[model samples]
Target chain A: MIKALEDDLSQTFNIHFKNHDLLDEAFTQASYVNEHPHQGLKFYERIEFLGDAVLQIVVSEYLFKRYPEMPQGKLTRLRAAMVCEASFSDFAKECRFDRYIRLGKGEEKSGARQRPSLLCDIFESFIGALYLDQGRDAVERFVRIVIFPKLDEGRFDHIIDHKSELQELLQKNGDVEIDYELISEEGPENDLTFTVSVIADNQKLATGTGHSKKVAEQNAANMALQKMRGK
Target chain B: MIKALEDDLSQTFNIHFKNHDLLDEAFTQASYVNEHPHQGLKFYERIEFLGDAVLQIVVSEYLFKRYPEMPQGKLTRLRAAMVCEASFSDFAKECRFDRYIRLGKGEEKSGARQRPSLLCDIFESFIGALYLDQGRDAVERFVRIVIFPKLDEGRFDHIIDHKSELQELLQKNGDVEIDYELISEEGPENDLTFTVSVIADNQKLATGTGHSKKVAEQNAANMALQKMRGK
Candidate 1:
């Protein structure tokens, strides 16, 4: 079964697993390992760690060069938006990467293998395995081939417009209504500070204080934006 | 004058500069270029860009292996905290890096060279120039010699207490009250969601959010923590 999955993943990722056990370990969720530790299998969390870093480096470099004039803070926000789990899950599903994930009887019965989060993890672990098997340059090449295409196709300018982008996201996701509240105003009349809180439905998401109400709103919006983006 | 500066720098940084122009450019503030065309200099912003990525790669690789069990998010935060302009300024000042910066008559009168921000830029730009002149390994060695000594001396628990460190900084800096406010919450009741804004001294410093209010507050604190850590 492991060999067959390796063959299947090799076709999808276009890289053969030298030691097939790497793939086995990646697919073997901690639940399964806890159930049967004698299998000598580990979970993909370590690989996930490595792969996350690799993804950040690759994506950050791409965005840095792509938007050379952009300041560091914006670049950070953009990278966060692009490599977020939701986007990664979308990419993973598009590539049908979930089919290769190994699942225990319980997870398999519950259809946990098809989860976007699980798919994203397995995809990251796959990159980690590729790095181990083929090295950094090889992993970079694979990532560029697999991931950059989607990022390139994306309307990145929309990402820079944080408010509209976030509004669209909340609407599409059926998220609760997010409202901005003017929580406080302080300081001298000439240079007053405005404190704004972004409240989603009845709960507050983030509060921001700025020299002006607009800036405070934007700050609050940006924070709320990132929160949903991380989803 | 250049030779004297170089000797002083060499004694401090333990690295010899084969190209004095690179060193001069590294230490040249934008104000310097406003006068003295024969100073033949450029500002350090471009070099800061190059150095930022170079630092990220080096630190990422180092942290990846140093704490084999650390998560990617933690490594990222640690690297950001370590490589920020504020930290660079502190290190550079400790080595008298600001003293070497050349300024135009006007800037010299204003003490532009002594400004922490300018000093930090020169230090980072110097690292970029070193990477260009000597390559990654050499630059890495130079960084280790100049800065990591003090960082290494900290207790093991320092790695895990970014918020506490920031709080200590606030205490030392004096009279700054920091608070985090929940701005918004989204998603379903069962899963929930939250965003938080961090206010420092009645000014919004940063905002972050996660699955729970605690996580959101921590995230906001962490962002502010990163912002405060470098210098």
Candidate 2:
């Protein structure tokens, strides 16, 4: 399966991998590693990390100039909607990542490969592999041609607006007024640091810091979000 | 000035500002109030808010389909860079927002229009005004025609990767033990909340919450990024 995948991808991406382990890692779930450590199924966490940034820059540049009259906030929201986990999961499903994913016996039986979490991670890892194998151009072209078109046609299909999600999280199940507070400041006056605390009923729900107060608040709000996910 | 400005804009946008106040507000800086209490210059905050969402959705939809193979992480960073205050300021300047801005005597003397913060706000306000006047179509067209082109050009520009910045921040700050921890949980068994803390030197440097632990940690790590900027 590894050889077949490398053969299939090599022609498309125009790159050859010296080590099959890289591609194998991209398709290997963490569950697989826990089950068979001797199988050497490395997880794709590192690749996901690299791939995440690659996608951000490419998509951002596309949007920044694509909508010249757009204000910053709208652009930010749009980007979030387009690039979230649900969307990634959908894309991964379209690519049939579940079929190729090397899952642990438990995961395979439980259909964990189709889970949004694993799917999104594997998709990101695949992107990271492409980037590592052939650099930004190969990765960019593959993304633009394969992934983006699917996302555009299905913009609202699996999209989650972070602000809307955060707002809902604050309103639901929590017995407090969720407020974002700027807790600290640092850096030069031109570029400042803002530490924001997501407080529910005056107790800190979560706190995050960012370059701007809004960003810090958003981070804290997102923390508050995870604190209230399924509830 | 209102009529002349309207004439000039109408030539390009084919849109008219029914109330000149909206136009004025789009260009006004809060600093206008400092010098002239009676000078009734409405600041750009409201318009900035509206424009922010408009810009986001437009860019998001465009990007979602434009780059199909790119991973979520890279897409996010790119969007941030494009929608950041600095880029908005640049866009506002390119649009000559300063020349049209209605400033009080003090702000005018202080070159408030040229100020990045004020310009960024005004840029948002302009989008807000467009949205209020013409709905999404008008705003969308303006974004597609004006804003996106600039971003398209930025495709050639190098992007700053935030996650890598996180790693560098830890290394530079000499925090060998910097890592993310799961702090709390919420939600049902199907979906969960994960609160993550970024710790260094056995102290919580920052905490972020998200629907998933990965997102929570990313949010936390990004928040921790404030400590590294300009350092």
How many backbone clashes does every candidate have? Answer: 12, 41
Give the lDDT of residue A31 in candidate 2: 82
Off by over 4 Å in 2: A1-231, B34-41, B151-231
DockQ of candidate model 2: 0.02
Q: Looking only at chain A, give the TM-score of model 1 against the true structure.
A: 0.63
DockQ, candidate 1, vs. native dimer: 0.09
- Per-residue lDDT, model 2, residue B209, is 78
Query: If scored against the real structure, what TM-score would every candidate get?
Result: 0.53, 0.38
lDDT of 1 by residue, B14-122 (tens): 6787777777777776777778666446666656655666666666666665545455556666767777777778878877777777677888888776677777777
Q: Report the alpha-carbon TM-score of model 1 versus the true structure.
A: 0.53
For every prediction, compared with the true complex, DockQ reads: 0.09, 0.02
